[model samples]
Structures are given as C-alpha cells and as structure tokens.
Target: MSKKNLQARDISWLSFNARVLQEANDPTVPLKQRIRFLGIHSNNLDEFFRVRVATLRRMIELGGKKGNMHLEDNPQAILDQIQMTVLQQQNEFNRIWEDILKQLNKEKVYLTNEQNLNKEQQEFVKNFFDESVRANIIPLLIESLPQLPYLRDKSIYLGVVMRKTASAYDQKYSLIEIPSKVVGRFVQLPSPPGEHHIILLEDVIRFNLPYIFSYFGYDHFDAHIFKVTKDAEIDIDNDVSTSFVQKIEKGLKNRRKGKPVRFLYDKEMDAGLLEYLIRRLNLSRRDNIIPGGRIHNFRHFMDFPDVFKAQKKERVPFTHPDLQKAQRVTEVILQKDVMLHLPYHSFGSVIDLLREAAMDPDVTTIKITAYRLAPASRVINALINAARNGKEVVVMLELRARFDEENNLEWKEVLEEEGVKVLIGVANLKVHAKLCVIKKKQGTRIIQYGFVSTGNLNEKTARVYADHCLLTSNRSVMADINRIFKYLENPKTTIQHLRNCNTLLVCPNAMRKRLIAMIDREIKTAKTKKTAKIYIKLNSLSDELLINKLYEAATAGVELNIIVRSIFCPKTDQRRFKQPIHAVSIIDEYLEHARVLIFHNGGKEKMYISSADWMVRNLDHRIEAAVPILQPAIQKELKDIINIQLADNVKARWLDDELSNNYVISGDEKKIRSQIETYQYLYQKTGKHSEASSH
Candidate 1:
C-alpha cells in the first residue's frame, strides 16, 4: 500500500467523532438525546488526547522524524489539524446546544444563567450555594502562592480577577477548581408554578462571587470558566522487583502531573486573563488552545436530570427476552449453545451462568481472564463465591487496563483475599482476552463449558454497550482455553499441550496468521468466480499490515464491507484499492462495541467473536483471542445483527472518501434505528414479552 492508500489513524478517529457530532446536529433526534451525543463526543475527544495523542507525543520523543516518516503528516502537523477541526466542531456544538436550549424552553424548561435569575430563583441559588457549594470551594490566591497548584486533567476551573476600587492598579488573580464532581453540575431552582428552571454550577458560583471573595477586600470581580486536557498516558518504570500492581498505582499518580495537551477557555474571557493563564501554565500557542462556551464539561449531560415526566424521555428499557428469567442458564448451555446480544439481550445470563457454576457440586474449576471490570462487579463476586465453595478459581487479572488499573488492582486484592488464585497478567504483554471456562461433571464425563465475548464482562457497561457473547460446551474449544490458561500461568510452557482446536482462533501466536490465511482463502475463492464476501465490525481498523492485506483481498474481487465505530485509516478511493469498501459508522443510543468478522468460506460462512481489534497492539503486543462461531444458529444470529446494523439508515453515517460524516438516508422510506430495532428483534425472537389484548 502507498501513502495515498492510508489515512492517519488519529485523523480517522476524529472523522468518526465527527459522525457523533453529526448525530448532535441532526434535528430528527430528540432534544435531550442530542445533548447527550454532544457529551459523548466531548468525552471521546478527552480520551483521545489523554491516551492516543499522548502515545503519539511519546513516539515523537523516542523515534523523532524517522518514526513519523510513515505518517502522512508529522505529529505536530496532525495536532494542528486536530485543533482546527475541534474548534470548528466546538462552534457547531454551541449552535446545537443553543438550539436545544430553545427547544427545552418551549417545553417549559428554562436554562438560566446567573444574570438572568429572578428574585425567587436568586433565593434558591443562594441557599443551594450556601448549603452545598461553599464547603467544596477552595480558592487559591494566585499571586500570594509560592508554587502553582497542579491542575487536574479534564477538570474545569474558574479564573478570578479581583480588582480593588480603592486603587486602580491594585488587582489580584486567583483560581478556583469547580467542585462539579462533588455537588452536581446542574442545580435545579424553584420555578413559577408550571415551569421548570435550572442553572449551571459555574453560573451559581458566578452568582455569588462577592460571598466567596468578601475577605479579599475587592470591590470588583470577574471570572471565566477554563479547562485543560492533559496527556493521561501512564509510563511505568521497568523495575523487575516492583509488582505490576504497584507499578500501575505509581503510574496513576504520575498521570496527574502529565503535560497539558489542550487548553480551553470561555470565548468571552478577558484577553489579558487568557494571556496570563497561557504564560503561567507555559502553554504554547500550538497546544490546542480552544475557546468554548461557559460550560466546559458537557459530559455531565450524560447524567442529565430526569426532572420531566416519564414520557418525556425515550421509552422504557426492555429486558432481553432470552435471559430475562433464565432458570437454568448453565443447564441450557450444557444442552445447547446460547448467544447473548447485550443491551438488546440482558447480561444477566452471563452472571446466572457463573452463579450456577459456583453452586454446582459437579463443577470443579472456573477460570477467566479479565481486562476491565465494573466498579461493583457481580462477576468478581461470583468468582469469589466459586472459590469459597471449594472450586478451583483462577483469574488472570490484567493490571494494565488503562484508566481502570486502580479498580482492577483493588479487585485483585479482594479476589486474592478470598482465596482465588489471581495471575497479574503475563510479562510484557497485557492479556486482553475475555474468556471464561468452567469444568463440570455430567453423567460419566467432565465437560468444559466456555464463553467468549467481544466486550468486557462488566454489567454496568453491558446495559448500554452493544456486544456479543457466545456460550458453548464444545470440547475442542474448551481444551484450547485450558491451554491458554496454562500458558498464561507460566509463559515458558509450551502451547503444545492442547492443539486440537479446530473450532477457535487464539491470538499472539496464531490469530494474525490465521486471519491473513482466511483472507487469502477468500481471495482464492474470489478468483475462482465463487461467492466471496468479507464483513467486519470492529471498534477500530488501523494496523497497516492487515489493512494492506485487506486491500489486496478487495482487489482480488472479495466483497468487503466494514462497520467501524471509531477509527478507520484505509482510504476508500478507487486508485488505492480495486473496489471501494462499503463502510459506515453507527453512533446511536447504544455504543456499537462488538468485534465480529464474517467471511464467505465458499458457500458456508465463517463468523467469529473477537476480543481483539485489528490494531497493532492487539495483534502483536497483547494476548488476544478471536473464537470462531461454530454453531450454525449462533452464526446466523451474528450475521443477522451485522445485517441489521448495516441496514441502519437513521443513525448510521457513511465514511466517505473525504471522511465527511454524511448521514445515510434512504429518502422517505421506513426508518431503521438499529439499536431499537435489534432490541425488538431479540424480544420477539425470545418471546420475552406478551402482546397487549385488542381494546
């Protein structure tokens, strides 16, 4: 592949986010939902800088120009482009927010600032500030302090400029960190009978500036909302003696002091104040300094108050029919294969299976590899209970799950205390695979039951993230899983212990090679004039080697289609590949997170549920897994889900040659909101709900 065939992964990710921004701008969406989309876009950008941009910066420092030679533009140049694009997006975001606010007002809900408060609203604001906000406010006198206080990454701050009326030149600068984390960002005020009123915490603080700075002997005051996004990449020291958990803990502390990658302030901020902040923070002009609205952390909108009537929001969430009240989850798995589609299908089935395995006298051992887990994880509890029940419970807890390292470490300590054998991942490689295997005695034999998922076993996230989990009692796959656990326990052990895996694809040693080989087979079939097609749904697609191979397969006449939720670096131009890839990204009610790959192996199709994306880290550095969907029923279900997502004309946006997020509208035809439609499909299939009688 040549330079023109590839797009920068970072740029491509931004394009995907632009698709999210398009959702916010789409008037067809509900007002509240649109604001939530804006929040998601902002939150996504924050992580991109903290992790991805930080990695690029480190690469530039280590490899210099030579490292960036393969990139279409240098890191600095890409940063500039990101800044420009973000600024434009910010402008659009403000417009959409204003439009939403107007719609909200028409619905009898008003968002007012400090200056727009009525007498009753003023009383409510003052009381709320006194009771909730005053204790959390810690004002730092900037001029008097000896050392500058370190600002937290992605935290909003208020820059205060205090001027004394007695002397024209007597002025002081101060800073106050917004306690949005403690007291909620949105404050509801008593409204006139039949009206709803709300104010931002920033504005509430803005309302009572005199009360906070009464001791400062200043008669005049002004403050501007500002925020800084720092590089959140954790750099662990390579010390042999330090435990992986300790290293992660130490690295998390170091994350707080990371260099700022972006600075954002209110557009109407005083020019002198902005300049002073830039100088004091040592922020270069190129460090993505943006001018945003008064409110910086719109991510709070994700938890926006449900103050209105129940009917005002989207319809009530439905439980997945298959697992709504599964009485014998493990028994069903033992008898036949079961597939779970998250959000659409309840994640309770996974939990119920574990719980059953814990209490089952026939079960002897339970093993799993965890990457990211929920805060109050039922998964961990079930494993602990299994260990307490005298079952051999082995858990490979990856301590290097970025941003969740601390939580994972805490879980590790808890699990270890509960007598569960915990492995803190393999050396130099993070175990990114999500696998759970249970050994149970049935009749005259010990059967191995296994589960493979495309997402973390986190119930909290499973409620909103679209993922797939395959539960199977296939002997061959279970043996391969046993081998994986053995290798994880002792890296030097030969993987030859279990090689009868004709149904699964394990990574690091074989996944990439197997995937390439599969593509090659498809290419051969295509050349022979047989029906050849390949469909992939992944979070990201950036590995150049795999991408180039995909292009080759595309040129060989394989029908290629991709549904990437985040990043895609492949060019869809005619000059680059023989066929233009049909690609779209769906940013809808639920996050599209599953990694599924389907290939037309002659007439019979092959489907897989993978814990790995087609990224270099997943393929080369991490211990990942992608298990083949062997059951015909499960394969058909996976294919159906992918097809539903592809047919999404409402929430799906095309990833075009120019990377513009153009909505895929089927022009006045039936609208298909994939998330909702998928939920209905699963509900109907499982007979989870009964129909209402005709009136």
Candidate 2:
C-alpha cells in the first residue's frame, strides 16, 4: 500500500471508536451493554484527545521539526479531521442516548433532569443534596475572581448564570464543579412501585441551586454541564538532582496545570458563560471547542445504575482444566505450561501461584513487571505477602502508566514499606511487558517458574479484557525474563542483559528487526509459490516500517489475516496485490486486547503472545516482550481462538480502505460472534457441560 493511501493513525482510531458507537446503536445488544459501550466510546475519545490530539497539537507547534517524526499528514490537517470526526461521533452519541432513553422509559425507568422532576423527586433531591452533596461542593463566583478558577480535567463543571427573575441584566457568572467523584454521577430517587427514577448528580445540584446560592438571593438560574479535557503529557524535567519518583510526582502535579486541548460544553449553555469560559480558558476554535448535548462527562455513565429489569447473566469463569486438579498452581506450571484464556478461565490461579510461592519454604525470590494494576490488586497482595514471608520480591512498577500514575506511586510506597524492592523502571523507557519469575531452591538447584501475558496483571480488568497468559517453567523464557529485570535493576550498566535475550523477543533491541525478518521470509516463500501465510492479532497496528513490509508481503502474494481492535493504519486494498488482506476489527462486551502473531514457517508454525502492539512507541520506545508458544498444544489452542475470531460474522467490522466499518456478513453461514464462540470452544474443552453463552 502507498504511504499516501495509509490511513492517519488518529483518523483510524476515530473509526475504531465509531465501531464502538455502532455497538451502542445495535438493538440486538443488551440495553445495559449498549449504554456501557457509549461509556467506553466516551472514555476512549477522552484519552485520544488527552494523548493523540495533544501530541498533534505539539507537533503543529514544532512546525518543520514534525518532519522528523515521519507523519503521513500535516498535524493541523489531522487535527481538523479529528475535530470533524469527533463532532460527528458526538451527534451520533446524542442520537443513541435519546433512543436509549426511550427504551428505558418503556421499561419504566426514567432519567429525569431537575426541571423534569416530580414533587416527590424534588424532595428526594433536596434531601440527598443536604445529606450527601452539601459538604463536597465548592461553588465558585467567577465574576468576583481576578481570573477564572482552575477547572480540573476529567471533571464536569456546571456553568451557571444566576440572575433575579425581574432583572436579567443583574447576573453573576458562577462555576460549580460537580462533586460526582465523591457522591457519584447517578443518584437513584424514590419512584412508584416497580418503577425506577434516576437523576444525574449535576441535576441534583441544579435542583438545590436556590439553597446553594440563597445568600445572593438569586430567583433564577441557568446551569449547564461542561467538561475540559487537558493535555495529559507529563513533562519530566532533566533535573538530575531529583529522583525518578520525585520527577513523576512533580510531573503529575504539573499535569493538573496542563493546557486545555478540548473544551466540551452543552450547546444550550448560556452564551455569555460559554464566551467567558472560552476566553478565560484561552482556547481557540482550533483547540477542539466542541458544542455537545446536556451531558458532558458520559464516562460516569459506565457506572450507570443497574435499574433495568433485564439483568445481565454473568458468565462465571471456571478453573483452567490443567489447574483444576492440581494441589498447587506452582506444581502444574512447573510440570507443564498452561495457557489461561482470561474471563473464560479464572485469574485466581495466577494469584494462587504467587501465594504458593510466597508460603513455600523452598521459594526464595519473586520478580514481576507491572504496567497497570487493579484498584484492589490480588497480584499486589500476593507479592506483598511474599515480601513479608521473607522472600525477595522485586516489582518493576511503571509509574508512567498514563492515568494510573498516582495509583502506581501510592503502590510504590506501600511495596517499599512492606520490604518489597520496588524498581521504578529505567529512565526514558516505560516497562510495558507483563512478566513474572519465581525461583525456588530445590535441594541447592534453583528452579524457576512464572507467567508471561499479553495484558496487565490486573485481576479486575482480567475479567473484562480478552487476554492470554502462559504459565511456564521454561528455562530459556525464565532466563530472558530475569535478564529483563536485571536491565530494569540497573538500566545504564546492565544494558547487555537486555541485548542477550534469546527465547523471548525483546523490543527496542530485536523484536522489530526480527519481525521484519519474519515478514521478509514469508515474502521469499510466496515468491517460490509455496504456502506462505501470517495471522496477526493486535489492539493496534500503525508502525510505518512494519506496515510497509506487510504491504510488500501482500504484493508478493503472501496471505495475511489481521484482527486489529483499534488504530489500524494499513490499507488492505492494493491493485498490485495478488490477494487482498483479510482484516477485521472486533468490538463487543469484552475488550479485545491480546496481541498474537502467527507465522506459517514451512508448516512449522511460529506463534507468540505479546504485550506490545505494532505501534512505533511499543516497538521502539517502551520495554516489551513476546514469548514463543513452544508447546504444540498451546500453539494450536491459540490458533483455534484466532481462527474463531477470523470466522466471526457478528461483532466484526471489515477494515476496508474507506474505513466504512461495515459488519462482516456471512452469507448462508453460521452467525458466529467471536467472543461468545471462543468462550464456548474453550469451555467445551474443559470436559464440563457447557452453559448457554451470554453477552
């Protein structure tokens, strides 16, 4: 594919979010999940603005220096496209929300604003506000201030125009940050029997605006919700005197004062208040000044009340067949490698492995890499237990894990206090690899066993994120993991350890080079007219060099099947190609997050599960790893799952050149939804009677 034909990464990302919006619009999807999909789309877009949009704005500021970055389109052009795409998505979002509201009302569930509340709800809102919200609110009188008060990112603020009923001229512009973080976004109100009435936290505040600002004696108030998404880039200074942790702490503090990249407000907001906000926030039209509906932070909708009568039939995860019979998880992993397909299989086994290692008399050391973790992480708890049990526990926690920076920083202190040696990772490189290594002294001979995964060690996300984890005691893989930890221990001095990794493909050293070589091999095989095929699954694929190589392979008649969930940049269509690339994106209840690569090497397939996407940052900037699927059975299992995804007619969108996001329709074939089918396939293999698949 020509570079000119390649989709811009940000544009492709928007298309991916559009797929999410499709899920929300899909009537077949459960109403609850459809609402959740809206939340997911909103959350994804917020991050896109915070990071991708923020980066483009920076590149535009850099001017000619952006050429060094090898961008496909001008930064300003991409920003303009992004703004247009976001506006369109927002319109679609509003339509879907309105439709959902109708459906909700049909189910006798009402979402009412302050103005639409009944007398009973008005009393409840007042009581709820006085008891729950009164202490948390800090109403700002913006007109009295010399400059506008600092508006926090990821928070929604109610822009108020308070004036006496008789005199519209005597008005005060005020801002009230919704205390949603403390009091939640959704407030349940009393309703008629068997009916549910829900109100937004902002609406609850709006209903009590009279009491909140009664001292000023304002008889009328015009309040509308607005949100500001700031540039989340942490500018880590070159202050050698400060520790890495201190730099992160300082960077996080500075991030609060970041430039506002996007200012989203209700279109019905008071005109004067909107103008005041834009001028005071120093945001121009180019800065994504978007006019949205009444709702600003739909992210809070992810936790929308479960008031619907149709409850989601939760699919309980079963123990992996290989682990079910084992006395201890360590025993099974040490004997044979076991691949745990998350959400379908229990994550408790992983914690069990760590806990067993902690209590085992022979165990001596435990090492793991953490990128993002759960709020109440069982993995962290296990590691902490091991530390208290006198085992040497080293956690290479990445403090720069985007929004999880503060949480990880707090974890760092807790780990250190518990005697666990916490390594904050190397300078200028985030450890994105998910790996663990435990050593047990077996009669003077050290035995190593642990896990390698394609996702974070977050138990909570494990339930919702489709990922793969390999529990293994393979000597070479364990050695490579240890080598990676050594580099993290002393990055400047122990760089050789990272370079020496053999079994696992280590990024920023050999992964990219080796991946290109693998693609070249496939091209050579295709030229010979022999069977040459590659199947890849990733959350994203935007690396230019790798994309170019794939294009060359396609031109050489090599068969390629790609299942990318987001940010796919490669154009599957090319006139010179001997065959078209089969590419699709899956969006469903579970997050399709695993990264897998398969190479049909002369009938001997080479398979790997990786933590990295094919993005330039994952390959060239962050520390990542991909472990080979050594066991034939495990490789076949992974291949089966990939095949299931490839055969999906439902929830799979054809990734065409136009980025139309058309659903993959299977004419006269079974309607296979990949996530549900994969779960059934794995569950059946457990030799237990399978339950019906649920969304």
For each candidate, what TM-score against the reference?
0.94, 0.98
Candidate 2: pairs in clash:
none
Tell me the tens digit of each residue's lDDT in model 2 across 616-675. Answer: 889988899999999988888999999999999999999999999999998989889988
Question: Would you give me the overall lDDT of model 1?
Answer: 0.83
Taken over the whole model, the C-alpha lDDT of each candidate is: 0.83, 0.91
**Candidate 1 at 381: error in angstroms?**
2.1
- Candidate 1 residue lDDT tens string, 1-695: 56567788888888888888887887777676677898898898889888777767666676565542333347767767787877787888889888888888887888889999989889888999999999999989887767678998867999988899889798888899999889988998888887888888989998899888898788888899999888887778889999777888889999999998888899888788899889888888777788887888888887777665444334334544444565788767777778888876678788888999999999999999898898889999999999999999999999888778888888988999999999987766779889999998879988899798889999999888888888888777787788888888887666554233455676677788889998999999988878889999999998888998888888888889899998888876566455788888998778889999998988788888898999887887788878888788778778888998899988888877788888789988888878767766666786555342110
The ten-residue window of minimal lDDT in model 2 covers 64-73
Model 1 segments more than 4 A misplaced? 63-73, 312-326, 492-502, 575-578, 688-695
Tell me the spans in candidate 2 whose CA falls farther than 4 Å from its real position: 66-72
- Report the lDDT of model 2 for residue 163: 95
For every model in order, what is the number of clashing pairs? 0, 0
